[model samples]
Target: MLMLRRTKNFLNAHGVEYEKEHVNPLMVPERVYVLKFGKRDGEFLNRFIVEHSYTWTGRDKINKITLRLHGQKHPREFANEAKLLQYLEKHADRYVKKQGNKKAGKNS
Candidate 1:
């Protein structure tokens, strides 16, 4: 599966809401993007970002997929999987409401 799809599936399975931002390299003309999750999933998002490496070769290859978990402290430590899940669980209601709003907006 493509990276974006995999990432989206991962978030959906965990009941997290996310937005994707695509960044194209200017010099190499390659496709690269950053997937950013909302503050509700900040902890898990941090872990995902930390575990992945971001590097580019000759600007031609899409080097890295940057995962930005919103509302995290600048330069925060990587959160553990269990902690991330706990955070998500705690905020489940808020996430559900947000998702509902998103769906409603799309319909309109």
Candidate 2:
């Protein structure tokens, strides 16, 4: 929970816009958040969604983070918060650039 809170704070402080949605609660109480970019003209801009699930009590207690990116069939799972943050920081700019180029191509 602490790691998730820190990640949310970091995104807020960096002025990043993201949408959070709750995944199936009956099965697993997981939260899925996606970083959004580009113009919305009724077209879906493919991006990555981060899904995390954690529990504090019981033997089933677990803290897990997974990232599902564009053009990738399999999701990349992170064992810890540091690695997840590092991955986000490294690829976020690239996605922004790609989105800009996509918009530019449409204008041309």
Candidate 3:
């Protein structure tokens, strides 16, 4: 919950309003987070749904997956956006960080 607060605060400080919505159990998500940043292809701002999972299993074995974005049309991995959780905890850096990069930042 602390990480979520900081995330929302960080975005809110940047003049961006972090959005929170009640997730549906049908989506099979335990939680959800979202934010809107500046505009795009049609002069409209793009809002991204930030989805993350800690662990999952298939065939009774651990599965590896990280944060992803579900575009209105399809789901895709936006590697860069992982940095949005830079200041976030919850052992997120392990999956979010790229190889040999000290941390998730613009330079990273």
Candidate 4:
């Protein structure tokens, strides 16, 4: 919960738009943050989701932030908020919607 709050605060402070959603309502019940940045031909060019997870068995596990990027086979886990924020800031980009007729703008 604390990790998620901190992530949300970072996103808000950075002016990064994101969506909050549950990973699985019935089974997982974990909430995740989805963010889309940059665009190509009106399609999202970069996308990623952040999730928080922990375990309660044996020694108590510390909360970690998981970042899953599109087209990646595995997700990257981060324990430091600054590093995660730095990564997100580096990848985040402003999306400008293309103007005028799409097909006519292309070369013959």
Candidate 5:
């Protein structure tokens, strides 16, 4: 109770709530969603085991298909181009940061 009282007294004395509330200026996108897919295990090289089962696809379709057909046969490893830059460049203006008065979460 003493700590809470002290904090309240300090806030009241400082009057920070009225001291020019800083508006977080940002371009709030209309839609927000998570982009999840299989990431390469190698840090130096974004490599993944790709076989005939794992084919390149748009919008992470390949990853989904690989998940479905995984471990059925021997897979051949190859470099996957699922990097953030390539994805963003491919689909421009699709996602944007949602700035609001909310607590940060995972990947936020």
Candidate 6:
């Protein structure tokens, strides 16, 4: 896996906007089998929904989760994250508006 700094640099170079979600390195599973057997995938997916879904209001408009499984060959998790990102990117306008509405409601 690549170092976090390297990942950040790569994303920056590619013009990808991202937020880093700090996590406990020791708690992160290094293998796909462990993630699947330990039920981390389910938890991650749920967290992803909560973070990305524009159902909540406030300053937390975008919820970016940075995983430490950099070199891990977890194709499933990667695919899931990619799918979510694609969905968000495809309907970015709607999602942004939804987030705006959420903030407006909070302000009022």
Scored by Cα lDDT, where does model 1 land?
0.46
TM-score per model over all chains:
0.38, 0.51, 0.34, 0.42, 0.16, 0.24
Which of candidates 2 and 3 reaches a greater lDDT? Answer: 2
lDDT, candidates in the order shown = 0.46, 0.55, 0.41, 0.54, 0.27, 0.33
The clash numbers for all candidates, in the given order, read: 0, 0, 0, 0, 0, 1
Q: Write the per-residue lDDT of candidate 6 for residues 1-108, one digit (tens) a residue.
A: 222344345335544444334233355333121111112323322122122313335222333433333234442233334544555456445312123234445557
Model 5 scores worst on lDDT over the 10 consecutive residues at: 60-69
- The lDDT-based order of candidates, best leading, equals 2, 4, 1, 3, 6, 5
- Candidate 2 structure quality by residue, lDDT tens digits, 4-86: 55666666665555555444446657655554433245433444355555446432332556665545688787776678778
| True-structure RMSD, every candidate | 10.6, 6.7, 11.5, 8.1, 23.6, 16.1
Model 3: CA > 4 A from native = 1-3, 27-29, 37-44, 52-82, 85-108
Tens digits of lDDT, candidate 1, 11-95? 7875665655555556664555555554443432432332322345422233333323345455333234344445555655644
* Global local distance difference test of model 4: 0.54
Candidate 3 lDDT by residue in tens digits, 1-108: 332455555555544433454333555644444554443443324444545444455222212213333234553344433454552344333323244545567975
Candidate 2's clash total is: 0
Ordered list by TM-score, greatest first: 2, 4, 1, 3, 6, 5
Tell me the deviation in Å of residue 10 in model 6.
15
Query: What lDDT does candidate 4 reach at residue 79?
Result: 71
lDDT of 6 at 100: 25
lDDT of 5 by residue, 30-91 (tens): 11111122223421111122221212451222221111112336433213324423443453
Query: Lowest-scoring 10 consecutive residues by lDDT in candidate 6?
Result: 30-39
